[model samples]
Target: MGGPSREMTVMRIPLKKAKHHFGASLSRGTRPYNEDAYQAGTIDIPAFAKRRPISLTRNPKGEIKNEVTPAGSSSGDPQVFYFGVFDGHGGNECSGFLMEELHKYIEDAAKDFELESSLQIKGPVHRYIGWSGSAEVDEQMPASGSAPETTAEESLGAVKTYTPSGTESMKPPKPGSKHDGPTPGAKSRQSPLSSAPPVKQSMSVRKAEDLERELVMDWKELVGGYFRRFKPEWFSMSAGGRGHPAEQDVIAKRHYPNSAVPNEAVEGIGIETVLQYAFLRADYDFVSAQVGKRDEDPVLADRAINDDDILGHPSRGGKSIGGTKRFKGGSTCSMALVSTPTPTPFWHPAAPSTVVTAHVGDTRIILCKTATGLAVPLTSNHHPSLPEEATRLRRYAATFVTDSFGEERVSGLANTRAFGDMQSKRIGVSAEAEIRRIEVTSAEYSFMTLVSDGVSGHLSDQEIVDIIKEAQTPEQAARDVTSFATEVSADADNATTLVVRLGGWERRTEGGLGSLGTKELRDWRKAEAENPRGRM
Candidate 1:
């Protein structure tokens, strides 16, 4: 905020018997508070010998059984590389929360694959989990009760409609119109603290709260059950069931139906679904905590409630007054997951890695091709101006307006999709992520870049790629890109950059801005020389 606040992180990831380098840099640029957050690391999945099991096997009696033993530790745990960047608005709390909890949820969601076996049969399962009909099954399942569940959006009628051309604002619903809320027999979205049964709406209508509850219950049952299976002492020692009273009650009263022995197999959902699940779960937890709902899980509790740096009510000058967490803040999230290639029948040893990109809001990821320094965009920004995003926001009759700076804003938010903007939830502001997958050959791509809007807004994709290619290391690449953003933008926002070096990093062909002696390149070099270590 004052002098630039800069932070750097470097990670060494093992990929196909080789060490890969990745790093991140964050710089507070002209902002009173730096709300951007990012993370990079690895997630270990149990390695199965031949095939990875998604669901538990069933016996003749149709009762679920855990066949794997606790001591059955397998070899070759597959590690997934994870990189995420979050940009916060209104406050830093939301981004900060994501920095700590998003990856944990992703790891938990990944476990849904080998839920039972993952616990007992430890080690990385070599196979990538392909799409199964689990989502279809969940979609087809009837709502928990006779009546359908209601979402907050339903309670508040559409007051406006946003379109690619412009926004059309509508008058408030007529005094006695259908905008009043859910009809009789319809269940309302409940707070995690509420004793009311969670609203089980259709997938199309399900809110973040619903998914958050499902995640918590699933963890309590699946993981807690794992501890319970071994020993009573171990369960207690593991603190398997510690949490809010309401959560504990829910856990005690119900269990994951999937945990029950099934007559047929239930395959785990694909990685795309896992990413979506994690994004929603993390968003829900953040929103719920803002309203004072806290979980006992150490990781969840630490970020949700214990961080003193978390922003409080905006009305209270954005600082926690009297040690109480307050008000709604929002964060945009972009993440990339790199998993080992699922082997083909022929078993090609040099298969490309599968890269999954999932995100909401304006942050994005770009892949730099080694052949010609090509910038390939993996994630698209979700702004109301986009046709698809505009159509989605229109369902809630959301309004779009141009700010004084000439940027389009949905309702009052810059992003149509984001995490933790609780106030805008009713108007169809969403945390639902856009998921994409690609196979990257180490010979074709040099690296991947993940950046918050601050950097992307100031630098073109090719320019970013060229800057990273010009750097000596991932850390320097991150710093150079972010520092360059500040140099170009008069009022640069908090800029954050992450660079992931791939196998082709050393074998790149010069092209685009990287090969040109452009004025931009000269200006960047001049700025770098003058302030080699300015702020960041």
Candidate 2:
């Protein structure tokens, strides 16, 4: 591939025709630690208030139509389905935390966008990030090879806020499950300290570590408080300004993938600002939660522009109720939010009215057009080797060094941007995400592939498309893609994949509660997807 002849030959090969499939798979590649994570579900507009669908009469005097209505819950107002993949790096902490909170938080933020469409109200900007682990500890936690990757639900307990009270619980991918974790490989990560700092920790490093714990707790409380209940401060940034110019044509093209309204009647709201707000907050929290009051970091200036006061007063508990411990870990994430003007549909809840693609780090969100099988990438990688990202690293004075593995890392990290690398953020490794507007037109659209770098780093997008085309079903495509990478990729780290299809959600009208949709698909990759170890 080095010479002009090789390069020309590579380009000469025709791109494979894209195909549409309905299967989904997740594979943990040849890594000791399977840090990759994913979540797919429906997000409904949270009601400003709670009301039981059917309430019993208290003394029957105030009848008021409170009789036997066969209590059924509302599907959700302006419902949208979400699919996300978190590629944890330093550790799984950040990914675990994000899997739990990111979608719910974005749901809360969308209220502002919904209001913008109407000429009536003014609102404030609300921002927060759900990062796991404490920044004070620079050491990676002990690897849990035998343990299953924890669900955000189990990790955070029951997050009672906006989640539907009676909706069935989402199950964690079971052990021995196909789409669970890493492929059955023993390539566990060696000690991260292999790239040690020094015989003795520097006074500066010690000082930063001690201070970071308290600072991280501040943002944790701020984010946790937002989930407890709503306050005026959450909407302080709502006073509207014409947000970044969105693709004007996006609104007109997308038919209501999941929405109750038609495309012609839709209005493009100011959601871009909301996306930026979420990205900035995740990075802001990461940096501020790590550095001292005196560190002369450039991001500090952007901090002033964002303002910490936006969080209102920091609560006194100084602890997250989620009971999620602070660990020294980082994770890369790609989340897709399909916002539409639907009042919320009944039978077709998971339809694709694609609106926004949000991301950070190398996890990629790729759009595959089913009509022509054209592959459209929605995100660009944020890695140190990338020219622009490396420039930002140099500007921030990141101590770049080649690790024992001959891979360039920022203070021993493989990637440049993430949710919870307090250590990296101190040296200006930010978590600011790049948000893009994508209008999903049903006619030209197909399923989307959201994956961690383990897959992208090894196989090209075209190759993945080829696999999709060759496989019989979407699930098989996921399996083939994951199996190929684990068996063949150069690094074979944790490979997690989510194949999202518009209009794929179908709820059973007869199931009482907590029942799975019609698709009885099996998961190919698993956290414990590794080979069974022999007894000593």
Candidate 3:
């Protein structure tokens, strides 16, 4: 947990030989209080090792009953590792919520995914809302009236079929077909088909799109349900733990297409999807919570308070700022979920793992390669300046202005996507996460660094990688990263760093800081030349 404390908080769990260990360091930097948080831990996945045999028994009426025994749980070490860094803007409430509860939601998602995978159980989405397993019916009804239950196939039938236009074909491009357009994250270049008519989505693709959209909506509403029940006030208490009314439909109506999903629910559930669910859920929860009772209070609805104003609220007593309670604000989220092979050693040189990352706003995750000592970005920041993001915002008629410093902002917010910021949500400031997956090999990658803008704003990706590379341990690396940020810039925002040592920890780096180290060596020589052996 992180807050406004002046002293930096550090946490680490040392493993044998320091392999596959993690460390987190958070500091207030030059700010009055810190609004950043980081969480690192392993999630327990039940390993069913044995099962009891089924038996037939006689009931009271002499009717034969079939009895099935549940599988026995194995007490094995948890395999899935979660590491994240949250940069809070308005206050620590959003980040705090993420720190305290986001992992639980992720765990639940994982459990549900596993259940679906093993037992082929397609549990109702309502099970997630308010943590109610018995609540099967969608509490959220249609605007017209309550509708009868329908299967996924039936739901697909209700959606309109899409037809292709121009040269577009319903079938996917043939294998090995050359694509003139640049790949994702590649430098934008002019393409011959840039001006071609847009291809329409096929019905199968549209069905997947609808499924994905509904999943997102359901997760968001689930989080919103928890938020609605959070307040101790009479009205909220009387509401009896329900999600926001009509808000779910409002979000569903939004035209955000191409959020594609594989039609197979069981097989399609992956770590990337789980990460997205966690992020979207938390974002919706925080922002929807702030809008509570806003209609009754004009000030709350019409005027939003900055972090400082919220901290200096006259009603507050002598307590320090950046505590958990907050009305409004937002935070950028960057997280890495590592799925280690079950029953196999993790972070071992022999073990290969997959890292699935979810990111929103400017917070970032980078992997340090052992061979080149280079920083490989795992996530891209969601800034308004990005051409794709700018176009997306414009599609929703949202406006952004470039500051005198040339930083693009959406309604005075630096991040185009983040958690909370209720007002910004209306203008297409989305909580939809950008997800990426990578396979990690112990021989190639050394470790990963998750950092907030406080450090990233001042330090280059390679510089941060170099700083961490020079440290002897993950804890030291995390501390040095935050400390070096403030040393480089006194006015750095709340600095935080999370270093997770991979299987290739402490491997010799050929780069060895290269120019960065050369500059230091040059400076040291110059200093020695200027001063005599014992001169003071």
Candidate 4:
């Protein structure tokens, strides 16, 4: 007999270990605090109140991958001092994501030519929806009550097969053995082992088809709901300026819940909303300052007036400095995309060519001016009561005053308008914020600090300004504010701060005091050599 016939079998083996390496560190738990219980806490709230000329930046302890640069001063582009403090609710993920991606999104939006085109597009993009066909009913029917039975041959064919050792190939069966099966047409029939019946294998292809149809239907409903809820508000150039067209006339409106009622008003009301609005306003404000056309002759004339030369100077001959209008209170987000004007081939003193656009968000923005002494603000509160916020809050009959949130008086939340929490809007929360443009003169250099309620909640605006003012740089200012809030706040929530300082101005350097660098380095080397096992 031929040596046991050769055959091959393949087996799959799974690996025992996962192939990914995740790098992460555990953060220490925050110090506990009780809101219902009041304990005295001391912060150096007024240490920096005396005006001082200084520059600083503060970064919280972490690994940051982005470049933090001071806004530059150039003739062509307006330098922007960008800052923000993000207060987190629910979890830290949202706040962290905002810090990492907010600027990128803004920059990307700024560069999109399609955005400009979309603004000019007249009509809405109409979408056509359709449904799929349903399963057809069978035309022919089987007799009364019995289900179909499987044939013997078909049942036998469904039985599983196994190979025996020493038999490389499978054969149908032997003629008379107990384990052997007989051919259907043979003279002597041999039964299968133990006379067991064969099992039937069923393929329910129709059931699978039914499930797929249901899934498709569910998906269609989901898509429809998504579109209905998030209908896009296409861009429009006509919507520029604060209170220009007025808040009531704007097509967009916020619907509130029927149950919400205004009780005791709050102080520093709408602080978060105001800060956010201000930051966006700063962006627009600075952009307008840099690019808005003003006749050079008039600006010179205004500057030329002095105690003795008032009569000799010509009356300011140019039109008033034009800027984008302030927004009404209820508006949440704004965008403007304008084409840069072409420079005149020949210098025309009368024609000033520049393009400026402005946009605003509901929360805060940071602005830093390096040219002037630091002036701390009372608080960067953006509560609804400010004139800029009035129009936005009119629809809801909402007013910013002490006790907005029941009895809590110093609710640091400022802006009446912001993104997220649609439910709040239903309860008379307005999402509108004002946007304005203010010129930055040679005597005035300023940086903006934008933050959400998270940071503002625990610290006053002046306190924040003071902290930033004391720091050596804008980055340090931001980090210090965050750290201080984290150290002091009674609540456990997300907090963030952005500090943008103006650059291109000259200031005295600390290094100018003396040349002790070599001596310090030498001392460090000697100390390290002596210690040998030092950790530094």
Candidate 5:
């Protein structure tokens, strides 16, 4: 967490080379105290290639009960992987919330999808399954309300229908008569009287459309559900346990569309959805929690002065933090919800996996192409001044003002979207995700990077990619990136980076200056010229 102290730590983990793939992270440096965090790991989800047994419970007489539980949740996997980076501003509380809760929210969203898929067997729009809460949820309060639900029968009922009698055009001609008999020299007759009925959509297409809309809504519910539930309780304590979260959602990345599109691309929709869900839901919780705060000022003030480190660091003592700030802080989230290639029963199980990414600030995730050693940015910065973004704010009813650098900020926010900045949320500053999906290919993918604005603000993506390409190992690559950024990039705030290598990476063992302390430039260049590309 970044705050007063400028301390940092560094370490490495060695995995068995022959079997397990290697993974590593380096967070050892100070960036305005480093309020950024990263997570790179694997999680298990259900196998959707085959239909799962739905009636999972038994009755008193030992007979199977008719259960309507959703189908999702696989026991085995080549394994699902997750990679994320949270950049915090105003303070770390918001980022901390993301570091701890984002993945759970995504997983829960998956379950909601499975449940909806199962629910389609019964009447569709008539019955809403699971929990229904305060109008605050259904209405989403300051946010947009959900679209109206509809069943297949109801939605398709409007499509035109025709009888098999084929209108007035299908009059059967007498056998071997003028209509059926081809008179050798006779001109074709009476064809102008026959015409086909207007085209109507097939039942298959209508059903698919219904499923598509339902899946979209289910995703909205699952993606942001956890963020909505956890932010308030953790902030105020009284709201500790509100939403019912016993069962979790298991979000499938590219595969498992079930009865949806038969031949879909490997990557899912791009740039914006659930990731926005997280930020908005968090803000709603924070804003909603602010109620009665003024009346409870005495209690908050006493707690703050006595607990100076309240909003920031856990070890330091700036104790009187958010008391003055009123906890009106926020965090920028840039994460890649990755579903890596695994053995699945779903179509194209042999095909590659896809990445669904979302962000609400300057944090970035760039994919480096290994074959050519080039940087492929996964997302553009979400700032109000970025052309379309500027237009978007105006359309969304958000106000923007030019900062000292002439960049646009929604309500003075550096980025267009974020979590928990109650002030920012009121204007056009939205948590709505600009979603995007990128298909992960074989050797074309080198590394997918996640970094806060602190690091990105100074180092260019190409520069970062070059550093990564030249480093000896993952940990070494991260160290080189941040150290170079701080020692040279000139930015002052916290700095952190996470790297995911698509292929194997190895460490370098060579001789040179023990560290990158001051050295004569001419001699250093000579030494650099002498080393191979993989050595430094």
Candidate 6:
């Protein structure tokens, strides 16, 4: 019996890949620290007005679930840009599904409107068919696909009654009478009545108008039902470990009518819906570029370039020292789509198009107004330090560790909010996404860096800003910042960086090697050098 039991136990052990508990890794606590630096070389170049552009990079720590979608339309009729970043936790199913379906839904809605409009202009054939006593029959057709046929009396009630005998006397003309017979050899006369002054057909005109109105109303109702049916498939939530239909209802209630929904819940549906409509109303275009060893390899670089070579060749960075891979995920995804229906009448030409970024466990949307040098942060970071996060942490009995950067726990994995890691959510560590709106002005345009916590974990925000200040181009700044982080946390896991710089405008070009004058710049540089790898 004991031998059989042992064999059964061995057989019952589950395979690692097949396990569903997303929390298994988290429950095991942090991985053993491995100190190795990954170094990639850097580029030295002068800043140019036209040379600046956005840059991105990513590295796999282990397994990651991040997806990004960027689209733009610049038809000159209405210019619009859209960008979205979805960071999935638990699994990639939700984010991946959303990336493909959201855009299609928007496009489908637009096409439905166009088709409805075209159907409104019914020509003469439509008028004749509609007038041939067919409308009454259609009205009695039991609402097309509805079940349960109507009774004969009910169907007949829908048709209008016309009694000829009561309305006008029917006088049968006598055989060979003058009214019925052709006059004997009288000059064949054309009836003056044939060209009688054109009688204005008000009834026909009114029918056409009614048809158009009905077509519009039907289209609206159909689209509304479609949205109601499909929106719930996008998300799922449970309460107290029990099945709750109300949760589905809550998400369904959030769907906007022909509008884009923001990540935030309090902002309500109207504002985001209207903003999305305006932004998507115009046409724009998008192109995604990557910078990393995998992308820059000779064979891979060839296919990444275009005829116009709008995206230059992939550039290499420092070497990867073994063990420096901070986050075990895929590369960061960044995209820029054009924003049409420009907010201003003056036409702000230098905006960053539309920027969307997603880290392995977070979602962020950023809009860059290059003309005004403003970086509007349309979403918030899912950090664990917020009040809501603190409450969640207490529920999980999770401890917090204070570092120079701020207060983080478990080497920052314990952030109150994150994208992936369903295991975390099981412990009440739910992610609360924040959406921020900041104006990016020229003064703030030095360069922008959007990175995963793998990099941010080790470096302070000011430290990153200083790196941008030191580098000549945005790409160089990204590399330098990444390099510094790797070096400092040579013992850390996967680290990644994405940098965006404003182009198409002129700025000061004087300080190359000696421009570390400002107090903010000096402080930032000092902080960066002191903690290059972000280790506290």
> What would the per-residue lDDT of candidate 3 be over residues 1-536, giving only the tens digit for each residue?
43432123223343323433667788898789899998876655432111111123312211111211122223332245678898988778778777777788766644544422211122443222212222222332112332233232332233222222331211222336574211222121111111111111111222333434555455445444323223211011122211122223323433347522222211122344444555665666566556542334545434444433554564353232223244567778887776542222334443445676777888878886655555678766677767767876776677789899777788898888888776676666666776665755434577888999888876657667777777778888888888877665545689889988775564624433432532353233235335665134
Tell me how far the alpha carbon of residue 275 in candidate 1 is from the true structure, in angstroms, after superposition.
Answer: 1.6
Encode model 5's per-residue lDDT on 118-230: one tens digit a residue.
11223321122212231212321121322232222332232222222321211223545555212110111111111111111011322322333443344234443223222
State TM-scores per candidate: 0.58, 0.50, 0.59, 0.33, 0.53, 0.35
TM-score between candidate 1 and the true structure = 0.58
Q: How many clashing pairs does model 6 include? A: 56
Q: For candidate 2, what is the lDDT?
A: 0.45
lDDT computed for candidate 3:
0.53
* Predicted candidate 6 versus true structure: per-residue lDDT over 1-536, tens digit per residue: 32332212211112122221000010101324311111111111110011111112321111011211112122222222233433332233333433433344334423322211111123332221122232322422222232332232332233222222322221323546565222110111111111101101112222322332443243234333211121111012211111111233334545757433222221111111111221221100000001111323454435433433434743343222111122222111222222211211111223222222222222222222222322233333334554544654555456667777564653345344432222333333322222222222222233344543444545544344445555655556556655665555434434445444432112312222212323343344345457747344
Return the candidate ranking by lDDT, descending: 3, 1, 2, 5, 6, 4
The C-alpha stretches of model 1 lying farther than 4 A from their native spots are 1-20, 46-75, 113-268, 293-323, 342-351, 509-514, 517-536
Residue-level lDDT for 346 in candidate 2 = 16
TM-score of 3: 0.59
Candidate 1 deviates by what RMSD?
A: 19.5
lDDT for each residue of candidate 4 in 375-446, tens digit (9 for 90 to 100): 222122333544434544454344345664442111233444433322233323322223232322221223
Worst 10-residue stretch by lDDT in candidate 4?
Answer: 127-136
Candidate 6 vs. true structure, TM-score: 0.35
Q: Could you give candidate 1's per-residue lDDT for residues 1-536 as a string of tens digits?
A: 44322122222323222323666788889888899998776655432222222222322211112211111123233345668899988878788778877888877765543222211222222111111232333432323433322222331221111122331222223445676221100011111111111111111112322443455454334333221222111011122212211233334334556543222121122444456667756765666556563223556445543344435532433233112445466989888776542211101122245566777888878877655555677776677767777776665467789999776886678788888776776566767777665654424567788998888875656667767877887778888888887676667799999988765665433433342423344354346446746335
Error of 4 at 465 (Å): 2.9
Each model's lDDT comes to: 0.53, 0.45, 0.53, 0.28, 0.43, 0.29
Model 5 vs. true fold: TM: 0.53
If ranked by TM-score, best first, what sequence of candidates would result? 3, 1, 5, 2, 6, 4
lDDT of 2 by residue, 396-451 (tens): 45667887866667777767777876655456555556666554322234456777
